[model samples]
Every structure is written in C-alpha cells, then in structure tokens.
Target: MNALPALPDSPGAYRWFYADVTAGEYSAVFIFMVGSLFSPRYSARVKRGALPLEHCAVNFALYHRGVSRRWVLSEYPQASVLRQGRELRIGRSRLEYAPDGTVRMEVDERCAPLGKAVRARLVLEPQVPAAEELQLVPGLPHFWRALAPRAKARLDVLSEDVSVEGIGYHDGNHGAELLGARLPRWHWARVHGPEETVVDYHLPDGVAPLRVTAGVLGTKSERRPLLSEARPTSLTGWGLRVPAQLYSGNTVVGTPRLLESSPFYARVEARRDGLDVMGEVADFRRFHSPFIRWMAHFRTRVERAA
Candidate 1:
C-alpha cells in the first residue's frame, strides 16, 4: 500500500463506518466542524438489508481556532491508540465487539476545548443474494461512495456564501498501507425552511481515477445526481455556540432518532461551550494509522481576525 497524501491539519472533517443490520439499512455519517471557519456536520443512514442492525460509532476531532493544537481519536478494537504529539492532545481506549459481530465503541474528550461521543452498530447479514459487487471503494477517502446511494446531506458551511466546489474518488488499491486513499471537498446549503439541501463536491482525477468516483445524494423521494450539475452552496450555521471542542469520560446517549425527512437519526452531545452536548453518541468506530498519527502531532490555531 502506498502512503496517502497529507491532509491539511488546519481544518477538515472525517467519518466512521456503521452498518445497521438490525434495521436492514446501510447507515453512516461524517461530521465536518471545519473549525467554524466553516461550521458543518453531515449525517446519513440507509435501509436495504433484511436483518437489522444499527450502525454506530463514537469519534471526535479537536482543533483550536488559533491555537496550534490538533488531535483526534481514530481506529478501534484492541488498545484504542491515541495519536497525539504535534501541538495536540491525545488518548487511547478499547471497544466492545459483540458476540453477534456488532461493533460498539466509546470516545471520551476531556480537558480539551471540543469534545463529542458517537455510538453506532452496523448489522449486515448478507442474506440477500450478493448484488453485482457494488464496487466497494477501499480507503478512508472513497469509502463514502459506498454510502452515497443512501446518502442525503446538507452542507450549510463554507469559506463564504459563494459557489462551493469539491470532488470524490474511488480506488481498489489506493496504495494506503493502513487505509484506502480518497480526496474530496465541497460546499453545501439548505433551501426554503431547511427542507431542501444542495451540495457541489469535486473529486480530482490522476492517482486513483477509476477507483475514484463522485456523486450527489438527496431525499429518498427525489432523484440525486450521480455527478453534480450545479455549483456547491456555501451554507453556514452555529453562532457563538462554537467553542474549542473537547471529549473525555462517561457520558449519556439517547437512542438514535431519525430526523423527519432526513437520512440521519443518531445524535450525541458532548461538552461544546461549557454546556454539555446532551444525547451525543459515546461509542463508534475509529482508525489509528500513520497518517492519523502524523495529523495528531500538532495543534492548529485559528486565523487572526482583521
């Protein structure tokens, strides 16, 4: 496996895997608290399989507005490795792999600025005859493609309210010794009472072109574009409520609830601004690899205000 290109530590977002076997759905979501430089959070869940299982995860990423601190709890099972060093905080925790093959995880963000807890359990029985190998995209970058079919997201965040852009790629062998390789960036916004969502993402071609693919996901009743046609929207939300994020310790989580007409249902709240993000997921999946460890090395400070 080759090494993945370095992702800027300044501001970015990522996701974990959770297949709902109990609900007979394929479900997963990614959060992009892009440091409020672009406040964003993405969620998605799909129902397709027969046997039902909840896809769950507990993960968090830490970054200071202007401080040079960066740390994240990635990877699961065995000793939960804590990737920290370069101006960042860190820790290590273990997970509970159920006898039924369900994956349960717990992440605690303490003594830090921003913290969160996520719980996801994906159950895939593979009962139905295998569909034409729906081209499984390996690596962290392109993994979202697998979930794209059942995905419906709202990007209401960007550098500014201009046409946002991004791309998604797929690859069988992304040369990632530890994980798969993928690169994507987009802008999104909500329309009319937040009932409608739109996004524009870019997936560059070159390294893993074919393995790399891009598409847009929308409401179940509507047809989403496999490739975007309109420019991405620059949507922003999260007023003052944004704080230096942190995660740590025992927390409470409510049963995942599906938002009306939305693809996401689970919600976990940890401490954000001296207040607790109540009902936040506590245990989800995480990955610890060389790239993640490198990223965990430093803290990123927010840009200075004029």
Candidate 2:
C-alpha cells in the first residue's frame, strides 16, 4: 500500500523527441521515442505466481510526401540515445546538430512495404530563436513541450528524386508518461505563415477543471499567446473529420483542408489569417482496448457544424 510516483524515475520512462519539416507541398515528420508499459494481463499473471514486468520500445516514424508515404521503424528495449545535445541515432539513421546551430538529418531506410529504400539528407537553419517551453499539464505530470516555429530548410530526398528548400518547424516533447496517459482527447495544430507561425492546442476533457485552450503566435524573434478555438467540420474521404474553422478569439482565422486521414487520426492544412496551418488531430481511444473504445464512444460524440 504505497503511493506511486507522479512521474516515473526509471531511465525507461516514456519520452520522445519529434521534428517536422515542410517545404512547398512536401512535408516530413520524424520521431525518436521510447516508452515503457506494463502488460494489461499483469494482474492475472501476478495472481498465477508470475512476476509483473514492463515492456519498453524505441520507435520512429517518417511521414514523407505529405503523408502519402510513411515509414515506421521500431526497436524493442531501445537501441539509441541522444548524445552531446547534438546527435540522435537509431540503427544507421541519425539527426545531428552543429555548433553553429544548424541541424542535419540523414536517413537511409529500407522499407519492406515499399520494396525500396528511402533516403534523404536535410539541413535546417533557425530563422528565429526557440520559443519558451509550453507545459501541457502544469504540475506533477508536467510534460514539457517546446517549439521552434520557423526555420529555413534544404532537403534532398533520394527515394523520390525530389529536392526542396523552404521553411520548416521543429517541436519536442519529453515526459515520464505516454501522451495517451496524460491527455485522453485533444486537437493539436501548427500554422506556418509567411512571416510568423501559430500553434493551437486544445484538450476538451483531458486537462481537468479548466479546459486546455491555448495558442502561441509570433515570428522567430517574438511570440505571444492568443485566444483560439478549433472545430471539426465534415468527414473527408479518409473518414476523419475536417475542421470547419480555426478561430482566434471570435474571428475565424483558418479553414482546414484534409491532407491525410486514417482510422483514428487526420492531418490537415488550413488557410489561416493569411497563413498556412498544417497538423493532425488524433483519437487515441481507437488504439486502446475494445472496452476503452466502447466507453469512449459512449462518452464522446463527434460534432459537426451545419
């Protein structure tokens, strides 16, 4: 009968570093993540005189060409680590940072599903200073989130024989618990404008007492919080609901266009306040157990504006 720690102290605690790059009409997202989870049958196994243990994994996802092609790689128990605040490597692919504040990412992955190799080399230079870390949940389980809203990127993708040079964004999150554990439902979006960037995060029922409705808007040199809102409009061909409008206070600033949709998530690009908004909204309940999904179905309703 002891109290569990608010955040896990083990090295195997859940955490992830993510970066996203977009240029013209092409985009790519990268994730270097690790997590530890207890088996759902732990109680049953313990009752049968078996020790309850934890499972850990290192996973990464690369969404190429606006989510048209996605490559996922995972290693159990994690085989990679961040070194010197500069390099992150898993297997052979790695993302590194230079002393001059430039980032380089080299990818050479053989994807079995595509029956081919996906290769790319990308360089990103910050066009603005890093933004202050945004705390999703204030205390105890405070998951730290940070953003670099704008950067100039030069990319050469060997797989598609495509080359792109333009602006990009980078964000990171580190926490002791999985995101699903912290926030059951939320909508996260990022807008890359001609001169500035905007990030809107909404958590309806996850953050407790006060609904989590916050936004950051600014250029690289400056940023300010804004009053914002998000609403899903209609279901697209991919079966994911599209946002009708993104509001900054009482004015509609963006209109969403679906870019990709899967069983539980949707990626969209919107024209917002004369800028371009691109990001995803996901429903984690579908990925959970059937009981959890059923409970979610009863407790949540997908709303659409008429």
Candidate 3:
C-alpha cells in the first residue's frame, strides 16, 4: 500500500493525488487536492498569505464513449478536509488505501454551476509496484511520483446503474511552492499496454524530461528525450496546441482525440491505443490575468458546510 505522505503547510504549498481509469466505452478520472493547484480561489488567497489547506478541493469526471457524462469540481474550506497517512477525506468523499495494495475511492460531489450529484465508488489494485520520486526542477521543491503506474481497476457510479472494469493509473505531486511560479508550461502523456506502461513528461527551462517505463520486471526511467524529435500537431479551439500522435521510444503509440480544452490546458486520449495525454501551455502565467481568473469561477462549484 502507498499511504499519503507528509504534506507541506506553508502558504501556497500544494499537494495532490490523481488517478484515472479507462474501461470499455467508459472512463473516469479523479483528484484530491490540497491548495488546489488549478483553483482560482487558491491563487487569490495564497497571495493574501492563506494556508494551502484552506483551498482544498475534489475533482472528478466520468465519461461514456469518449464524451463527458458527469463532471465535478467542488472546492471546500479548510475545516472540511481531513488528512491521515492511510486516508484523506473531503466532504462526504474519501480515498483509502489497504495493506494489500488495494485503493478505494469514495466520491460524493456535485457538478459546478449546478448542484447535481455525482457519486461514485472506484477500486484499484496495483499490478506494478510503485516507482521512485523525482524532482522536477533544479533547486525547486516540486516533486512527482508514479505510485502505481499500472493497476487493475473497477468503477461503479452510485448515482446510476453503471459498472465497468479495466486498466488504471495512480500518481502524485507535491511542492513547497506554487507550480506556476517556477514553470511556464508542460506536456505529459501516458501509454499503456497489457503488461507495461510508459510515462513521458516535458518541462521547460532546459530541465530534463522524465520518461519512465514500469512493469513486473522493475521501473526504468530516463531524464532526457531520446532524440530531438517534436512532431507536428494541431491547435485547440482555445489556442493551445497538443500532440495529435504520441510516441514512446521508437514506437508510435497512436493518434489522440481531444477530451477537454481550455486557453491554457488540453486533455486528449487515444483510447484505442490505451493511453491519454494532458498538456498545459501557459496556465499559471495567464492565470494572473483578471479576466482569466473570472473565467475560472464558471468551471468550479463552491459548497458551504452544512
């Protein structure tokens, strides 16, 4: 089991646990966030010297046949979040890990703008062992780890009659300072096969890229791109360019289809090839714009404690 690690408590420090699972015709992704890296509220409050835990949040999305079925991005106050080594709870939802490498996620959240319920229960069993943590930037406190690069997952939506089983992934990132304050943009992709998984992350400022391959044998990671190859791709409606096709090593993974798009970020998936890619062009820098911060409110929901 991979328990939650010690989190930083300074203002603007952030921590988050992210997981995604893809099954036949259905897929889902969820995250538990402290400091809420993408939160407009966090961005504003941190400037005022507020604690990172004060802006915690839970984000979950369910998809069917490549279309978004239910989306939730609910932010909570510091009083509503509870963190422990083996468990972390936000509102009525929680994430728990067992000694046998089983991870269970309980989600009871609501869609933004409207308060519609989006409840789900997901179970993930790690098939491949956890990998080591790597520092992203030099002299920076930010770090990332692929806790479970490969896992067997099952999902059930409690709000409706839905259940499925398939491949899944779990990872985490923690930092003592704001992510955008150090990096301008990044691109990341994960390609999976029956037994092996590959993760490629691109960073700016000449920092080395993180490429990892994990399976039963062990975990192998590279810090640099194999060669100077940047393939051409198209631009999103929001002006963010993304990779149309993903490559790991010398193998052509597959073409990607856009799942979500924004002025600073893009999420694409090559479901046929068993992989997904997420990219951020200028999220933090543009986030400083007043107009951009106002736009973010529409994508988030704020629920008061009962």
Candidate 4:
C-alpha cells in the first residue's frame, strides 16, 4: 500500500481555571493530557473515531467563602486569531460546553499547514471582571506572579516557541446534553494573571510512571515534575489534594481497577514552611471546538536552531 501522508504526533497538557467574580471570590482547575490518536499509539484515543466522552468530562464545583449569591455569568465560545495587516499569521481554537456545565477547549495550531509554528491564546470578554492587583511571592522563582479575581484559567503547553496574544471570545450556543457527559463545543474562562507554578500528579493506575504529568506556568517561570507514584484522589474547596489509595496496574495485574480512591480536598501548603495557603476550587463553564480535532491531524515544529 502507498505510504499515507505523514501525520504529526505530539504530547502536551491543558490547564483550566474557573471562578465567580460577581461573588468576590473564585476557584481554579487544571487538566493535563498526554499522547494523541494520530501516532504514538495512545490507548485513550477513541476507537474508530469514537470520542472518549468520559475522558472529555470537565466538571468543577466551587464553595462560597466570603460572598453569597454566587452564580456563573455566561458560558461563551472564544477564538484567538493572529493577523498582521489583514493577513492571518497563526493560532486558533474552539471551546466547548459539556453536559455537566463544565467547559472544554480544543486548541488548534494552524501555522503547521502553512509550514509555521502557532502559539495558543485564551481570550476573555471585557464584561468579565479582572483582578485589580498582583500578588508577588517572596521566595519562589523570580518568574512567579499572582493576580486577583482568580476565576478561570487555562494552560497551553508547547515544545517549541509560540506566542499567546490578541485573544477574543465568540458566542457558544451549542445545545445542552440530555444525560450522562457529552463533550463541550465552546466555553467561557475567567482571567487571572501572572503565573504560579506547574504541578504533576500520577495515579497508581497510570499506564507509565514518568508518564504522569501536571504543571503550572507562571508569567516568568514554569514548574513541571514527573509524578512517580501519585494520583489526585479527590478535590475540595480551596485546593485539590492527593490522597492515599489503592493503585492497580501491572503486567501481571491484568487491568487496573480502583480498589478504593481516597477522598481529600485540595489544600496548598507552603513547600518550605508547611503553611496552608488560602484558595478555592469552583465549577464554571467552557466549550470544545470541532476545529481543534481537525487541526490535530497535522503537527507544527519550531524553527530549527542556528
């Protein structure tokens, strides 16, 4: 058989944040995805183009602390297109709405088709309130920075140089789900700037040890660690913590099964002083784009080094 056209295969993760600004407080969520169906033989890839609807599930729950009458503003779809003097440069994406009222985003790097690299951008509407100030960490890396109104956030991981700028949102009016969890076609995300750190978690049932991945990218520096033997058991207000549980996955172990998943809320402790940091985790809405999956058929690489 004639060799098929080359398809790009790359692994990366996505981070998402949700918050309620009208209520004076908010929550954050991060998701890390590795491997793809195009190549590298990803088990998570849906068979016969079947969408792994379960894996695509994105749900967040927020607890009100200081404010009451908390509610979500609007769930819309946004697209970030780069242009230079009326000419499209690169970068594009579509957000989706899941049945659980959670949001999912399918990002596409269009520059690949034109033989260029694309940087993904997250666009928030002006109607959405933004933090008024920045919170500077004392001892962490110089790049770490924090901002107020921590409602929604997302992370775009790229192996090559990419730019994230000039992002804007569009209306996501996709129909609702009747039952179970359906993939999101569009979404709305809150904005919290500077950046903190990247985190990694490994479920005992993970396919590979080093394959466990998670992280936070600040405006300055990025933190990423391989989760050796860890998994996020449960999540509560202010933080998502890892709990002790039974992890089942082995060559002789047959298929991995959850004997018991420990329950624990999210809590941020001072890595140095062992102090609990104040925070919250809440549910917001977003959408996924069919365009993202279409663009994934191709891959883009950075300009070669000198």
C-alpha local distance difference test of each model: 0.21, 0.51, 0.77, 0.22
- Candidate 1 at residue 191, lDDT? 13
Misplaced by over 4 Å in model 1 are 1-58, 61-92, 111-228, 235-306
- The most accurate candidate by lDDT is 3
TM-score of each predicted structure versus truth: 0.27, 0.68, 0.92, 0.23
Candidate 3: residue 241 lDDT (0-100)? 68
The candidate that achieves the highest TM-score relative to the unseen native structure: 3
- lDDT: the better of candidates 3 and 4: 3
Can you give the lDDT of residue 167 in candidate 1?
17
| Pairwise TM-score winner, candidates 2 and 4 | 2
Model 3 agreement with the true structure over 1-306: per-residue lDDT tens digits: 556676568998989888888888887888888888768888877778978777778888887876887888888875333444788887777888877779888889888868688889889998887778888777888888988888899999988678899888888889887767877677777777766888887777667789878888987766874347666777778767677676655666566666666776666676445444432234566675677778889888886643
lDDT of 3: 0.77
Candidate 4, residue 89: Cα displacement in angstroms equals 17
Worst 10 residues of 1 by lDDT: 34-43
Clashing pairs in 2: none
lDDT of 4 by residue, 149-226 (tens): 222433232423322322121111111121102221111122222332211112122222111111142122222243
